[model samples]
Target: MSFRPVKPLALRTGVRWKIAVAIAAVGALIAVTLSVVVHNAARISMLDNAREVQMERLLFAQRMYETSKPKEPRFGTKINDPALPAQLDQLMRDRRRGTFVQEHRNGGPPDVWAAVPLANGDVLSLHIPFADRSTAIMNDLDRALVIGSVSVVFGGCALGVLIGGQLSRRLRKAAAAAGRVAQGNTDVRVRDAIGGVVRDETDELARAVDALTDALNERIEAERRVTADIAHELRTPVTGLLTAAELLPPGRPTELVRDRAQAMRTLVEDVLEVARLDSASERAELQEIALGEFVERRVRALDPDVVVRVVHDSWVNTDPRRLERILGNLLANAAKHGKPPVEVTVEGRVVRVRDHGPGFPEALLKEGPSRFRTGTSDRAGQGHGLGLTIAAGQARVLGARLTFRNVASAAAPGGVGGAIAVLWLPDHAPTNTGSFPMLRLSN
Candidate 1:
C-alpha cells in the first residue's frame, strides 16, 4: 500500500475548488442559453405587434386619402418624405399596401411608418410612435434577466464551495487516521462505523481504513506473540546449557562453550525485551535524578578508562533502570564497533555519547535500527542487531528521544570518521553544575 504526503495548502486547488468552478461554468451556460431563447421570443413578439398596429394605421390613412381633405386632421401627403424607410417607400411606389418599422440608433422607441401610393401619384403617409412604455418594459426585462443569471451562477458556486469543504474535511480526517496507522498507532480511527443507505464515498473510505487498520493490528500482534513465545521457550533450555557449560573443567575449549552459551542466553533475553517493548508491556518508573552525576556513574561502571564530561548539570524525571539500559547499550555499541576514548557528555537535560572510529554505517543513520538485519559486517558489530532497537524502544518508554548521526556527518561509503548519539530527556533541567568539573575522568 502506498500513501501520499500531506500538503496543507492543497485545498486551494483541491476537489472543492474544482467543483465550484464546474458549477459556475454550468450555471453560466444555462443562464446564457435561457437569455438567448427569451430575448429572441420577446423580440419576435414586439415586431409582430408593431406590424399589426402599423397595418391598422395604414388603413386609416387610406380613408383620409380618399376624401382628399387637405384641411382635416388626417394623414399628410408627402411628395417626398426623406425619413420614410427605403423599403416602405419602394413598396408604396409599387402601389402595394405595407408598413415598416425603424428602430432608433440611440435605443429609444422605434418609428412605425404607414404609407400608401394615391391615385394622383401622391404618397399619403403617417408616422405612429412605437410606444416608449413598451421599450422601457423590454429594457427592464433584460436587466432583470441579467441580474438573475449572475445571481444563480454565484449562488451555485457558493453551494459547490460549501459541499466541497465538507467532503475535503472528512477526507483529511481519514488521511490523518491513515497517517497515524502508518506510524504504528493502530488505535487511531477516522470515524465510527459507517452505514445506512445514504452513505457517501467518504463514509466508505473511513470504513475501509478502519477495516485495514484492524487487520494490520491483528497481524502485528500475532507476530509479536510468536516471538515472545519462542523466547520464553528458549529461556529454560539456555539456562540448562549455561549450567552444563559451567560444570566443564576450566580450559580454552570450556571457555569457548561458556561464552557461546552466554551469548545465546543474552540473545534470547534481548528478543523477549524487544517483544515487551513492541507490545508496550513495559512501563517507566519515573524519578528525578541529577543527570550529570548519573551519567558519570554509568560510564564509570562500564569501564573507568572511558571519559565523562559535564558541560551543564540538570535534574530530570525518568526511569533509572531504563536509563541505565539505554546508556549501557550505547556504551556497549561504542566498545564493540566504535573506537576508544569514548566520551559521554552531559549538557543540561541532554546526554551525548561519542566514539571516534569509522563512524556508524550510512544505512544505520538513514533507515534506523532493524532487528536481525544489522548494517554491513565491516562497519557493524557482530550481534543480532537488537541493541539500538532496544535502546530506541526504552527511550520511547521513558518519553525521551534517542538520535544517531555521524560526528561530522561525514559518513560515506565504507564509513568515515566518528559517530554521535544524543539522548534528550523530556522533563526537567535544574540550574546546577554540581561538584564535578566541566570534564571528568571516568575513574
Candidate 2:
C-alpha cells in the first residue's frame, strides 16, 4: 500500500489549520495596508517639495530680469537680455536630468514635467520628477514593514506553540487515565491541576474519567463483598461434612455413609454451580431450542407428580445447560418451600413454577431473593438459601428475567396463595453464540 502524508487539517478536525491560517492572514493584511499608506504619503510629499523648488527658481529669474540694466538704445529700441533659457536649463538639470532619472532608473514610469511662462515673461515649469530620497524612504518603509510583520508572526506562533503544547499535554494525561480505567484500574485519576480552563474539552474529559472511575470502584467493591460472604457460608458446611465423614467407621453401615457422602457431594456441586454463574468470564453457550419442550423435560426430571402445562410452542435460543440449571433451581425451590404437586406452565418463552403450599413470607417476598434466605415454611427441607439466588444469577447469565411473587390459589388448604417463580427468556440467541461457557468457582 502506498502512504500519503497526513494533513494537519485531518489530524485535528481542521482546528490547527484554522488557527495558523488566521494568524497568517491577519499579518499579511496589516503589512499590505501599512505599506500602501506609507508609500502613497511619501510620494505625495516629495512631489510637493519639488514643485515648491521650481516656483522659487521662477521668482528669482523674474527678479533678475526686472533688475538688470538695459543696453544703450539702438535703432530707437532698447536691447533685451532674456535670462529664462539659462534658468530653465539650470532648473531642468538640477531637478530632472541626472539623479532624478538615475534614482527612478529601475524601470518605473517616468515622472511628469510641464513648463509654463509666467505673466512677467519669466518661464516657470513644474518639475515633479521622481526623487531619490522618496524612493529610498519607501524602500526603507517596505523593509521595516516586512521585518515588523515577520517578528509579529513568529512571536504569535511561539505563543501559540506554548499554549497548544500545554493543552495537548493535559489532554494526553487525561487520555492515559482513561486507558488505565479501561484496563480495570478504577483508582486512576487525571490531574485537574494540569488543566487551566474549567469549561474546555480537557476539563470535560477529566470529569467523565472521574465519574467512570467512581462507578467502576463501586461495582468492584460490591462484588468483593459478595465473594467474601459466599466463601464464609460455604466453608462451614463443607468443613463439618468432611469432619463427620472422617469420624465415621470405615466398614459399618456402608449404605448410610454413602447417603451422607452423596448429600455432601450435592451441596458442593450446588455451591460450585452458583460460583460459576456469578463469574464474569462464565457465558452461556446459546443454541436454538423448543422453549416449551425444554422446560417440560426439566420439570418432569425433577418431579413426575408435578403437573406440567404447555401453553406455547415458540422456539428460543439459549444455552441448554444454563437453562436446565435455572429451571432445576426454581423447581427445587418450589418443592422445598411449596406444597406438592407443583404446577409448571410454559407459555411462549416464559416458564412459571407455582405450588399449593403456604405462600412465601410477605417481608421476604418484598425483600426479594438473597443468598441463604429460606422460606418461612419449607415442606421438603430447609434450604441453604442459594437456590433462589442461583436461579436468579443463572437467569441473568442466560439473558433471562426471573421474578418471584405470591399468586392467589384455591388449591391451598386455607384458600391462600402460593409462591410463584417466573422465568422469562429472550426470543433471540446470545450475542456471542460461539464462545464456550465458563465454570468459574472462584470469586
Error of 2 at 355 (Å): 0.6
Q: Provide TM-scores for the models.
A: 0.74, 0.44
- Across 213-289, the per-residue lDDT of candidate 2 in tens digits comes to 78767786677557656755766776676667777777767557757766665666666666565444467777889
lDDT per residue, candidate 1, 74-183, as tens digits?
A: 54445446787889788977888677878788977777777777777767666767778777878888998899899989998998898877777667767877887776
Predicted model with the maximum lDDT: 1
* Candidate 2 collision pairs: none
User: What pairs collide in candidate 1?
Assistant: none
Off by over 4 Å in 2: 1-257, 377-380, 409-415, 432-443
lDDT of 1 at 373: 66
lDDT of each: 0.80, 0.66
